[model samples]
Target chain A: METLTIQGSPKTPTVEMDAKSGVIEIKGRSIPENSIDFYKPIVEWLDEYASSPSGETTVNIKLEYFNTSSSKCILDVFKKLELVYKKSGEKGVVINWFYEEDDEDMLEAGEDYQSILKIPFKMIELEE
Target chain B: MTFDIEAWYGEINKGDVIVNHKGVITNDLITEILSIVENKLIERKENTRIRKKIYNVMVEALQNLFHHTDKLPNETNDNFGEKFVTFVLKKEKEDKFSYISGNYILKSRVKFLKDRIDQIKYLTHEELQLLYKLILNNNEFSDKGGGGLGLVDIAKRTGNNFEYFFHENKKDHCFFCLKILITN
Candidate 1:
């Protein structure tokens, strides 16, 4: 499968999905006016990637801020990943949720997602 | 029982007005407003935590206003155009900022909107978090792509109850105003 890369904008995040390295990273802000439209393609890519499973998948989510709309879309992306993980015998998929040290809100957001999903999540704190 | 939108708008447009926009709301406009507010907050050397909270709340407030605003009738005397929304961001103190947004809604919808806000008003932070997660996990997004999580998220971030009002207008419409304050 071809890699999916979308450059970040002021209102959206940078997304990179590579099938070869089994790495998917979403960085920067995600406050798109129409989040579904922005994330639809990424979700589709993941669906395709789920077919030919990667040996080990590492997903990194580093976002400064995202609106409620994007939050739902992010969850959709995770749900797709969860499917992949379950099909892969629940061993090789991991999500790294990166947040600034002082951003209690981001930390809580990651925790919220962790509580909802069965996949493993690492809460990585960065220096402000 | 007509409400004076102009007067109410004037009341809120006071003290260090960072942004005062009143007209049609579009996606482009929302983007512009967010950037402007973000830059102003950064320029003031505001705390990063408070800045993100304010920005997040503004995104929800503006998008909610964009989605739920009622179009004005053609024959109305009110100059408020179709999809009219007015929002003001002002600095109330050194570390306090206020965001106020107003838009028209059909009178019939007031009860539902009121009930929703009232339900959120009494929720403690923990309750709000639980409600937020419940709604987020549910696949019941509105026709407008809203999962009904905006207000809850705003309340959770601010850790304060919502202060809202509905003023009746003559043409079977009411003006809904929501006020949120972010303090350091």
Candidate 2:
């Protein structure tokens, strides 16, 4: 599969998806005027990647801030990964959610997704 | 101390204002505002958690202005549709930051806006979450990208009541003012 890399903008996040490394990352801010429009291609890429996912996949969500619209689009990406996880058996998908140590809200935001989805979420804390 | 709404807004935005704008709310302006707000948070040496909360609520607030504001009447009769809005981010105290925004809306929608805000204000934390998820998964984002989630998100993040003021502009239009506080 091809690698997907999207540059970060003031109102959007940087996205990098590498099937060979079995790692996907979304970082920076995501508050696009039309979040669905901005995230459409990424979601589509995930959908395609589902067919030929890696043995062990890792999703790193390092978001500074995302609007409610992007929040839904992100769930859509997670749902795609959930499908890949369910089929991958032992080497399934692992989500890494990073937040600063003092940021309770970001940590809680990750937990919100963890509760909704069936996948395992590794909540990692960074030193401020 | 005498009078003048515009000048009073300047007074409210005084002292450690991270970012402030009072004019047409454009997408580019929203992006610029976020960048300024981000830089302010970083400069304060605050942790990323509160920063994210502050940023998220700020996004909703800006988008609310972008999507819901009514445009001023034009002279060209071209219906250009541009509304003036006010945005302010100020350091309230040691660890608290406040975001204030103002925009114009039709008087007819006042009841709806008030009702929605009041309803969100009264919801418990768990209820806000449930309501958020329910609407999120329901795929209810309107054309402007609002799923009626902005107010709920604001109330939930603040965990405090919102301060608002309504100014009657004309017989049919008025300004909706909002003040949201985020504390670390």
Candidate 3:
């Protein structure tokens, strides 16, 4: 219903979820000490958003770096969105994964998520 | 058998010392150390790719030390505080950096830790990537919210086997040392 916006910190990323726009963006670093605590609310928000049925949903993930713990939490976020995609006839959701020019690790991270999930991912490379 | 924390600390605090931290490890401390090291890497004019890799590896290393450090054995007479851990980041060469971290672990975990690392040591790059993805997708997280992917991520980025040692202490504790190198 309401937009969920979290400011980015030194150890966490900025998250924005807008129900009206059907867009979710998570950008910046995500290496929190307790990732589940940081991500729990966002996951819950996604759970709530899944029921509303947006016409189209776009997710953008542009992370410079994320720790292993955050990695799992991120996967959870994707899995939740995958459900949203499946429920919306499989064509209403697309994920835009952005990686810096030479960040092979980040690129591969996106690829890993793409392979594991059943959503369409557009690997967009950004020039540094 | 006894392990001397001070002696071991001194031995690893060699080379072009960049960041040498000891005593308690906390979330705020990790943030501060990462900021300091990131600034230092920038000052040294490291390329973006290497800088991010080192930063990523350092996060996992420090957090691993933060989460997995065992309480100091009662018999051990060391001034290192509870949940004590240490890490040294030093410049090994113009295009290389080394990160060495140490912490205590229960003797019971030695075999499991050893076997896990041994299994990761022999994996090729592609195999390591596959393993990392597999573990990432797995929902099994430790009570501390760790997905057990830290070591795999480290090995994958470094492209090097882990250089580690365990020194037995009195009672059921062992001091663990892990060394990782990042190069262009």
Candidate 4:
């Protein structure tokens, strides 16, 4: 599958998704006015990745902050990944949530996502 | 309640001001203000957790101000112009930060806004978390696409009651104000 790289802006995250490399990274703040509109392309990218099925996919989420509207869009991205994980069989998928060591809120946020999604998230503490 | 915008603005301004922005709020403006406040917070070397909470809730507050601000002009602010919204972040005497936002809102929506605030007023942080999860899991959003988890998340992050007051102005409109505190 083709790679999807959306450079981060002041209000959005830098999204780099290369299905062939099995690397997906979304890092930065998400506070878009129309989060659904901003995330539409990313969601579509994930949809295509689900069918292509890469081996040992790794997803990294390193967001500093996201508005409530973006929260829903972020969840949609995770839901799409869950679909890929469910269908990919033994190829496997590992989700890594990176949080600043001093950031308890981000740590809890990862836990929240893990509770909802079928896949277990690896909460990696970011070194200062 | 008669909400006085001037008095409210004066009250928050008494503190050591961190950010004081008032006027038309646009997407680009929001981004600019966010980065400015973020850099200030980091420069001060505030606690990591508190800074994150403050930053997240501040974004929510700014966006809420931008979206919910009513254009219904009050005779007083009409000449001043701009569907005006005010956001201020100030440092208190202690290690406390105050995030407050003020904007003109329709008198008709006071009850609706009040009901939502009151519903969460008595809820503990854990309960608010449950409500947040329920809202997120249930796929709930309003017709305007605003039935968001913002208030719940704000309350949970701050671990404080959301304080709000409404002042009915002269032009069939009121200024809705929200204040929440963050501790380091």
Regions of model 3 farther than 4 Å from truth: B74-77
Question: Candidate 2, which segments miss by more than 4 Å at Cα?
Answer: B1-4, B7-11, B14-16, B44-52, B75-81
Better of 1 and 3 by DockQ: 3
Query: Stretches of candidate 4 above 4 Å error?
Result: B1-3, B74-77, B142-147
Q: Candidates' TM-scores?
A: 0.96, 0.88, 0.96, 0.93
Clashing pairs in 4: B3-B167
Q: Give fnat for candidates 1, 2 and onward, in order.
A: 0.61, 0.71, 0.92, 0.45
Clash count list over all predictions: 0, 1, 0, 1
lDDT for position A26 in model 2: 99
Model 2 clash pairs are A103-B49
Q: All models, DockQ values?
A: 0.75, 0.61, 0.90, 0.60
Q: Encode model 1's per-residue lDDT on B1-184: one tens digit a residue.
A: 6777789889998779988898899999998899998999899888898888888889999999988998878887357667988999998888788999888899999999999998998899999999999999997768888768999999898877459899887577888888998875
lDDT of 4 by residue, B79-150 (tens): 446678887898875668898888888888889989998998889878987888778777666654554787
Off by over 4 Å in 1: none
lDDT of 4 by residue, A6-117 (tens): 9998888999999888899999988888887889999999988888768779998998787788887788899999998898764578999999888887787788778888
- Higher-TM-score candidate among 1 and 2? 1
Lowest summed lDDT window (length 10), candidate 1 chain B = B72-81
User: Chain A TM-score per candidate?
Assistant: 0.97, 0.96, 0.97, 0.95
